[model samples]
Every structure is written in C-alpha cells, then in structure tokens.
Target: MELTLTDDQQELRRGARRFLAAESSPDKVDAAMKTERGYDPATWQRICEELGWPALTIPEAYEGIGLGPRELYPLMEEMGRHVACAPFFSTVCLGVNALLCAGTEAQKQAHLPAIAAGERTATVAYTEPSGRWDASAIKATATRHGDGYVLRGHKRYVLDGHSADLLVVAARAPGSTGENGVSLFVVPATTAGVTRTWLPTMDQTRKQADVVLDGVRVPADAVMGEPGAGWAPLARTLALAVTALAAEQVGGAEACLELAVEYAKVRKQFGRPIGSFQAIKHKCADMLLLVESARSAALYASLLAAEAVEALGAGGPSAGASAAFAEAASSAKAYCSEAYFHCAGESIQIHGGIGFTWEHPAHLYFKRARSSQTLLGSPAYHRERVASLMDL
Candidate 1:
C-alpha cells in the first residue's frame, strides 16, 4: 500500500508546524521545564483548543474529530519535532488507547467524551519502582471489599500522574499472580487515598510522577475489560504506542538533521561552508537516510496496527498480521531510537563548542532522544522482541 500523506494530511502537518513554531518558543520550553508541573496548564489548554490534538484519535461519536492512526500519525511527528512539552501523549495516545480497546460501553461513554473535549486528562499507571513494563510484573494489589476493590501499591515513573484527573491502574487482584491475576482499574486522581509526588527526570519538559495508592477504593465497574484479560489489551496498546513513538522519533531526527544542515551551510571553516566538507556532508547524508528509513518503518507499523484492529474485529487473526505489526513496530522503535541518538550526537559534534553549551537547542533534542529511547522499551529490548518474533 502507498504511504504518502493525503493533501489533507499535509495541511494538518503544516498547521501543526505553524502552531508549534508560533507557540512553543525556546523561552516557553525552558520555563515549562522548570515548572513544578512541567507544563503550563493554560498553554496546554490553548493547544487543545487550537489544534484539537487531544481528540484527533477519538472517534467522532465521542465528540472527537473521528480520525484514525493514519491521520493522527503526522500530528505526533510534528509534536516531536518541536519537542513540544505537553501531556497529550500520555493522555490521548496511551490512556485513551487503553480505554478504547478495553473499556465497556458504559466506561467509554463516561470517560471518552471528556477526554475528546479536552476537559480532562488521564494516564495509565503500570510501571512500579522496579520499572518493568510487563503486565505480569505488577505488584500492586487490589483486594475485593464488599462490592468494590481497594488498591494498595506504589507506581513509579507514571507520566503526567500528578496532573491527571483520572488514572487507569494495573494491579494484581486477590490470589491472582503473574498475568492471570492482573487487572486494570480507573481511579480518580482526587480519590481520598491517592497521593502523587513529581519525579525529577533528565527530560524535564515531560513530567513523571510517583503515585501512592493507599487503600484507594473503586467500584467493580472500574475494571477495564474482563478480569484477568488485561494482557491482551495492554499488549495491543503497547504496540500502538510503539508506532506513535516511532513517528515522534522520525520527527525529532528530521528536526536535528535540518538544524545540522542549516548550521553547516552557514558556518564557515577555511573560508568555505562547513557543509562543503566531506565529513559534514557524509553526516548530513546519513542523517537524511536514517530519517527517511525511520519514516517508512513508522508508517508501515502504524498501518499494520490499524489493519490488526480491523482484522481482529472481523473475527480472527489475519495471517501473520500480528507478527508483522509486532516486527515492524519493534524495528521502527529500535532503529529510530538508535538513529535519533546518533543524529543528535552528531549534530552536537558538528556544532563543536556551541553544541555543548546550554544555549543551543541540540542538547534538548539529544536529551529527549535519549529519554524516549528507553520509554516503552530500549533499543536492545525491542531488538530482542524482533528476534523472538522471527524465532531466530
């Protein structure tokens, strides 16, 4: 299938680019990074109102724009390019994906509309102090009390946890262990027993928090999907997240490459532009190749994910569809992470002393690239997944 963006998609990209350039200035980025919440609430609200970004992926039936992955993918890429500091990724991509995939009709009706309207923010709390992303790694316990569940556990590195109005938490129920006992619960952040503390991270623009759930109580209806069936939905959500992240990586890599290229063309050495030198030219060429390759991979994986959703709805796995999507997703994540890291490092190297200074934007991209590489899973982790999928 062709991967080119439609005219409308191009327009969307241009619009996002314009908005980021106009609103997300260097000063704004720096200020947001130092803030307690990692972003300005008013600015975030403006982003939602201006771009309709938070609702891009939500279906029209839920008051969203009703677009699919193909349309949403480019917008994510633009966000990455600007290193736009916001909780859109945490709430819209991850949390919304979980709800859409696993939530019952009542759950969807209750939560999705608010999210689509950008009136509320949400997140999924799964990683604990151990930092494992597996469903089986959950240690938080949710015990049945009367007709409800009481949660008692701590989660570390919960993105936007401090600011989220709602949280989808993963916990082990009663006597269940491993994947069999894990369940997802939706808890209001304002619940009496829920406490949140912000965590300092290398990428300060993106906030993370440590959450303490002390006998947090919720109704049984809060459980997403069927009890003990959390793994399948979580896995599917992760695959989609990997694809979105890959698109983000592509945007970041392209931005770094552009910055490096523009700098090289203007900066002179030996009475000649630095870009004229073979070393710099080779680096730029490599960066371009890497970005293009990453774009292809990200787009392919996203299409595969969309296709998988469609096929699953039609009753059975489409021959090799899941494996293809997994492999492409892993390949995109691993390759783009490594590629962006290299591009960022090289961009800095090309800039010499100025690159090391705090004044330059290269370091920001570098830090984001490094941090994002380890977000869902590291390059090494994804490579292992790719290999396992291939049975090699």
Candidate 2:
C-alpha cells in the first residue's frame, strides 16, 4: 500500500501546526507549565473548541468528528512540536481507547459523549507505586458489595489524574490474582473516597498525579466488559498509546533538529557560522534522518491500527493484523524514544552554554524527551518486547 497522507490529513496537520505556533509561543509555554494546573484551562478549552482535537478519533455515533488513527497522528505530532500542555493526549487517546475497547454500551453512552464534546476530562489509572505497566502486575483490589464495588488502592503517575472528571481504574478482584482477576472500573473523580495529589517531575508541561481510592464505591455497571477479560483490551489500548506517543516523539525530535540547524546557521564560531562546519552539518543530518525514519514507523503503526479495526469488523480476531500492529508499535516507541532523547541531548550540546541555561527552550524539549521515554515504557522495555515478538 502507498504511504501518503490524504488531502484532509494534510490539512489537519497544517491547521494544528498553525494553531500551536500561534498559541503556544515559548513564553506562553513557560507560563503554562508553571501554572497550578500545569496548563491553562481556558486555553485548553479554546483549543478543543477551535480544533475539535478531543473528538478527532471518536466515532460519529458518539458526537465526535469521527476521524481515525491516520488523521490523529499528524495532529498529535504538531502538538508535540510545541510541547503543548493539554489533557488531549491522556483523555482522548488513552482514556477513550480503554473505554472504547472494554466499556459496556451503557458505560459508553454515559462517558464517551461527554468526552467527545470536550465537557469532561478522563484518564486511565493503571500504574501504581510499583510502576509496572502490565495488567498482571496490578495489585489494587476491588471488592464486590451488595450492589456495587469498593475500590481500595493507590495509583501513581496517573496522567491528568488531579483534574480528570472521570477515571478508568484497573484493579484485581478480591479473590483473583494476576491477569485473570484484573478488571477495569469507571470511577468518578468526585466520588466520596477519591483523593488526588499532583506529582512534581522533570517535565513540567505534562502533569501526573498520585490517586488514592479509599473504599471508593461505584455501581456494578461501572465494571468494563467481563470480569476476567480486561487484559486483552488493556494490551490493545497500550499498543495504540505507544503508536501515538511515538508520533509525538518524532515531532519533538524534528523540532529539536530544526532548532539546532537554525542556531548553527546563525551562531558564529571561530571564523564562520557553526552550520558551515562539517561536524555540525553531520549532526543535523543525523537528526533529520532519525526523525524521518521514526515518522515512517509511527505512521506505519497508526495505519496498522486502522487496518486492524477494519479487519476485526470483517473477519474477527485478525491475529496477523494485531501482531503487525503490536510489533510496529513497540518498534516505533523504542526507536522514537531513543531518537528524540539523542536529538534533545545533541541540540543542547550544539548550543553549548546557552542550552544549559534556564532561559533557553532547548532544556524544555530535553526534559520532555527524557520524561516521555519512560511514560508508557522505556526504550529498553520496548526493545525487550520487540525481541519477544520476534522470538529472538
């Protein structure tokens, strides 16, 4: 199949690039990162209203724009370029994916519409203090009551947890262990026993929180899908998240490459501009190559996700499609994480003293790159997954 963006996709990318460049200038980005919410709620609402970003990937039946993964990739890339601070990535990509994959009809009707309409923010609470991403590693317990469930657990590093209106929590059933007992619940953040504390980190633009569910009670209908069938959906959601994140990393890396190139051309060296030197030229070239390669991988994975959705509708259990998507997602995540990290570090090195100072934007991108590498899984973790998939 030919790998090219359609006219509509190109338009979406152009629009996103224009909007981010205008709205998230370096000074605005700095101000937003230091805010109490780590972002400007008013600005975020304006973006959602103007761009329809939160609903880009949702189905039309749910009041969304009804675009697919292919359309979303470039939009996400542009957002990453500016290091735009918003809950769109966590709420729309991760939270919506989990609900779409595993939610009951009632649950979907209740939550998806609000999310698609940009009226509510949501997140997936899976990672705990243990810091494991696998479903089998969850230790939070959910106990069955007369007509509801009681949740008692602590989830750390929850993206947008403090501001989210809804949470999709992963927990083990009282008697079950490992993947077999894990289940997903849709808990309102305003529930009686829910508490949230923001966590400080290197990346100031992206917010994370520690969420404590102290005997949080929810109706039985809150459970997503069958009691024991949560793992498959969780894994699928994670694969999609990996693809989206890889696209973001590629965007960030591309930005770093451009910044370095522009600085090199203007900054004078011993006798001439540093960009005229062979060493700086080669570094810029390598950064370009890495960004281009990672872009291809991200797009490939996104296309696979779209194809898998289609194939499942046609023949059911498209193992080949699923495997292809999963492998590609892992490959993209691993390669893009390392590539962005390298680009960030090299961009700083090229700027020398200024890059190390707080006044420069290079350090912001560097911190984002480092933090994003550990978001879903580290480069090393994804490499191991890739190896396992290849049976090497």
Candidate 3:
C-alpha cells in the first residue's frame, strides 16, 4: 500500500537514486563508514552544493528550496538505500526543523542562511547518557549568568555532534525539571567548556558523539523561542525527525528485500536456483509485505508531519490534531523500526553464509536496522507513546 507519488516527487526520487548510486555505492559506503569522520568531505560537498539538499527544507526566505517533509522523505529513503554516509539526517532533519519550529525571526536569519548554503553544519543535543528520548529525560540545567546563561550537562548519542559547527542544546532552568522549565539554546561547537568526543557507534554510516557542556555560556539571544516554552517546538521537531527516519527505514527494508531477491535468483541449491524453493519464496514474500507496509507507514507519518509543521507556522494545530499527529508518528516509528529489523534479518537468513560475513552489505543493513530501531526510541517505547497519545 504505497502512497502514490506525484510526477515531481517521482522525478526527485529518480534523481536522488541516480546521484547516490553513482557517489555512494556499497564500496563507497564501506570506505566512508570506516573513516573517523564517517563520511567523505568531497562527496558530502557535492551532495550539498550540487543537489542543494541542505536547502530542501529551509524556507525560501532563508535561501532554500522551501520544500517540506513530503519532498525530503524520498531523498532520505534514497540515502538509506545506499547506506549513504552523511550528516544530512542531523543537519536537515533536526537542525533545520529546530530553527524553523523554535527559532525567532532574528535567530533564524542569523543561522539558517549558512545551513541553506551548506556552509555550516548543526545538530541538536537532547538525549543524555540515559539514552531516553522523552522530554522527561532531559536533566541538563541552564542558569542565568552575567548577561547570558550557563549550561551544564552531558549529551550522549548526538548525531554528527563531533564535527558540527553548532549545537542546538536543550537544558532546563536551574532547579526545574521535566517539560515546564526546558529551554533550547544554540551554542557554537567551539564554545568554551564544550567538548564533543566521537562515540564510534555501531551504525557508523551515521556518526554520533558525546557532548559535555560544563558551564557553557550563551547569550540570552541564543534561546530559540521563549526559554520556558520550547517543548512544543521540540516535540514538533522530534515528530518530524521520527517521520523522516521511518522513511529511511522503509528504504533500507526495501533494499534488503531487493538484495535477498537478487541473491535468491542467482544462488543455486539442489541443482536449481534457490528462488525455486518454497522456503526462499516464503522469505521473499514476507519481506515484500514488510517493505511495502513500512513504506506505507512512513508515507502516512510524513503526511501527518507535513501538516503538523505547516500548522506550527500557522499558530500551531489544535490539541486534538496535535495528538493525532503524534500518534501517527509514533505508530509509524514503531512499526517501521521492527519491520526494517525483521526484514534485514530475513534477508540475511536468505543469503545464508555470505550474508553473515562483514564483507557483505546484508550485515551492514542488519546493523543499521538494529541501531536505528533503538536510536530515537525502541519499538516498544514508541508503542507506549502511541498508546499514551491515543489515551489507551
């Protein structure tokens, strides 16, 4: 049950597939992930400057294409298909959404142009060592200082944190907890008392880092939106991020299915193609169902996300609409996370010994599936969120 793509969307998908296929082949993906930085600078530069992807979601006023999630989701799918090693997920999905959802006009003007131009990179700092993705998980503190605020906390699992030029950090007011006192601040990566150490995560196709801000100071103007009221925007950003990531999972699952099908047709067993066997046929059929279902889930989530983002600019959605959107986002995340993981595992099983080898791309997909399943929130966690949102 795939969502029908318009002509322009189809064309964009084709172009992205061609570009990633040429620049981010399996060998390239392997080489890039082995790098300390997790991606090649030259390739990323072309992805930005030539494809104008960082500019895809930024508003036209900010020197961007002014497109939204609908357009960007397909591109994300292509990235996943190629296991492309880039910070497009961190910069475009989280950074651009953070600024758009929470930043003041002045703040947006000051930061977004560089991102749209692909001259700077940024990522959000929210999750801590606890590895929780909820607002209740935020334990960082920000205290009023001399004409600025002092932030203190440790952020872990920050996407592309080690090399990003800026960090949009979330910390609450001193002595406050939970959603009420939470605030978002934009701090330069080079700021005093800030440290970002590479994490060497399992999914090296995308890098992560440990960010420690001990007395990191930022001007009051660094706050994105009102200090105590940032949760709404942050929640919006997460929903969009989940939707975007689900699309990527769909792409990966699809690729795994394709790889399995291709291998099944070629590899011989019992003097005939393995695809001729009922077991292989069953595996391929199951994979096809999972891939298609995941694609549908991601597409549905993307549409809801587009509505939510547009609603943000139009004074936000009604409480009911917001709940519905959150429910859909969590539902998609949960289903796609498990579906992708299961599909990857099945693909590996279909390939047998070759799939288990580190040299094969099947294991890479399996690794990505497992890592991504737990990144934002595990399938169980998202299911709980969906239940809560639905008042069940």
Which residue pairs come into collision in candidate 2?
none
lDDT of 3 by residue, 191-234 (tens): 99999999977788888999999999899999998978888889
The global Cα lDDT (0 to 1) of model 1 is 0.86
Q: Could you give candidate 1's per-residue lDDT for residues 43-157 as a string of tens digits?
A: 8888778678888888777888877778878888998899888898899878988887778878888988898877989998988998866666789998889998999999998
Clashes of each: 0, 0, 0
lDDT of 2 by residue, 8-82 (tens): 899989988998898887788899889757788888888768767888877787888877789889888998898
TM-score of 2: 0.97
Which ranking of candidates, highest TM-score first?
Answer: 3, 2, 1
Q: How many backbone clashes does candidate 2 have?
A: 0
RMSD of 2: 1.3
Using all chains and alpha carbons, the TM-scores for the candidates as numbered come to 0.96, 0.97, 0.98
In terms of TM-score, the best-performing candidate is 3
Cα lDDT for residue 339, model 3?
Answer: 91
lDDT of 3: 0.90
Overall lDDT per candidate, in order of appearance = 0.86, 0.87, 0.90
